[model samples]
Target: MKNRSLRIFLKIALSTMLLTCIRPAPAPLPVILNSPVGETITAADITFSWQAQQPAAGYIIQVASDSNFRKIVVEETVSTASANLHLKTDGRYWWRVRARNESNIWGFWSEAAFFILQRFRVVGALKTQGYPHDLAILGNRLFIADGQAGLAIYDISIPEQPRLQGKYLDSLNVAWGVKARDSLVFLAYGYKELVIINAVRPESLKITGVLEYPQPGYGYALALRDSWVYIAAGAQFIAVDISQPAYPNLRFQYYYPRNCRGIAIENAYACVACEQLGIAVWKLDTFPPRQTETFDTDGNARGVDCRDGFITVADGRNGVIFLQQDQAGHLTELAALELNGYASAVTIEDTLVFVACGSGGVAVVNCADRANPFLIATITSPYAYKVGAIPGTDYFFVLDRDLGIVTVKKEF
Candidate 1:
């Protein structure tokens, strides 16, 4: 009986010691130190701070544009409780933190703290059947270059609510770029070939032509002028003669060192956006197009547009670069507009320059002054992939990777 009592006493004493030794979970929830719970922050640079728990070895901070943390845009782990972040675009964002101990003991995620960036508002949104890569508009019709799903046509007579009129779903064709003129639409496939469609009637569109490329993935971006179709595809600037839409003949192919993204033409000159190679200018009038002048930029040149003697290029990450053609037809760098993220697409409307910054938003720049161009107004979106102006309206279409196409008017 005495031994039994002694053993029971020791067992109780050990249980008490273990209960005391166990450290309470190191601050399972961190208290947000800066910014109000639901305040709008104008500055793009954001700093997140939390209380450092007693035994925390490190802290992880996660921020997302969505509330459910579905897509964590920025995530970082630091020893301290404070972390500075560069949030993309202007919109509502949610953030949360979790703590970890030296022994790799992770604490529960803290309650989410939310904030808003009111730089731009959503005018209109539509969800496409598949990923909308590129689009072209003629009259009130919008032809979308859909990935995997082939071609999709929409009636944008009423820009607010775009009615899907017809679709040609091709499981084999992965469409990349599109250009619409008159009743004809030129579609570029991801792997190869350029398909042409005659859409005189939206209800019944027909495939009228098919152009095959020498390179498998060479049919990416295209610019059509009458019978000549200039392509910025893969690592080559290809000129296809489509005088007869049904029969496309490859006339010229200019291979650059880097991938080509956009192509623009002026008279006999062709300006190609050669990714890292900058803007390559070629004399297309020649039998074998000869590269005349090349303009180097700080960014990855993705798109180019030129008129009269002025040139504008969407230089990825480095923003927009404006160049002017001199009296001798030499290109000279004039001005530029600096943006936060990748400048993916650019369109010129008179003196206004519209730029689509990937996840950075869309900026309207007034380039009336070639020396000093300034932003007019910005349309903020986290997935601003491409921007294009409507043929004759004060409206512009911004394509989002997930949100389909967003229509915005030139308010400013």
Candidate 2:
């Protein structure tokens, strides 16, 4: 009897071991609710829903100002498939849901989402072909200067969509730069010299003034501040006083050995970027001009702009360079960022700087700290040529050589 009992006990033990090895593990609980992500939705005043792997005893809903839920706003336990959440705030909010089994083990939280709340407003965008070099907005209309298309006008009364008003195609060479003040429009035609027209009437724009150059080499860029208008030629900077809109009087022409590509005016000073001459600064009051200060940038300078006490230069080789000028007019290099592609143009508003890169696309940088600038974002296209930003909006307009116009908005 003892031998038989020992043999039966061994067989039972072997059978128990085989059963344990073949059994499968239990499945994980499913995520019930998913958060929404958008720019127009600020609060969570909608229904939150989810799913489950097995039958759940109940679900726990938690809402917080942070993703970690360190500061909890709401904690509720419910058994239904949906819960109504009425948020009273107008900022970013985080929420998640958890399901509990009959054994009381809780599952993991769902993914987090963000939403921005604000008064929505429409923004305008302008683009063109044949190299859109410059843009100027006056009143409610936008003027674009196309390299080979002459002057193109658009009525931006409706910011979201701009309607083409007309195109003044008198100049066949190229419209390099444009400036509008009062009712007059000044255009720099490549070899056609400076052509002025009356832009007061949208239905009809007539040529009112023309300044011919003896030997014109494409007028590349221009800037207008107060009554003075500065134009960049091959190797010369021409200053014209536009106190009289109908007729622009030539003040003086300053010559540089290297070709000038971009020009900008700030208060009583004008900043010019010479391809090989580096950067030259001149006083608007002085006739025939002498350089107040010249910085030796070891790159081909393409665009320049000045604001406050800071000067920004777009160098094709070295990227974008930021320089600070003291009250005594002494210059010091603050920052130099090496962008992969060529930095073609630089424009600043408040603390934000927009750089147009030829192939790398348009880069937005935060210039809050002069010594250390941070690139916030980049808007890329097949061939991004120019970029412009609206003063009070998060919208940025980029002119792409092949993609046409691309409008970018900050989703956060």
Number of the top-ranking candidate, with lDDT as the measure: 1
Go through the candidates in order and give each one's C-alpha lDDT: 0.79, 0.73
TM-score to native of every candidate shown: 0.69, 0.70
Estimate, for each residue in 190-230, the C-alpha lDDT of model 2 and write its tens digit.
77557788987867889887776776545778888777778
What range of 10 consecutive residues in model 1 has the weakest lDDT sum?
Answer: 27-36
Q: 144-201 in candidate 1: lDDT tens per residue? A: 8877777899989888778999887668768878898888888877656578888887
List ranges where model 2 is wrong by over 4 Å: 1-129, 410-412
**Predicted structure with the largest TM-score when compared to the true one:** 2
Residue pairs clashing in model 2 are: 32-50, 32-51
**Shift of residue 394 alpha carbon in model 1, Å:** 2.7
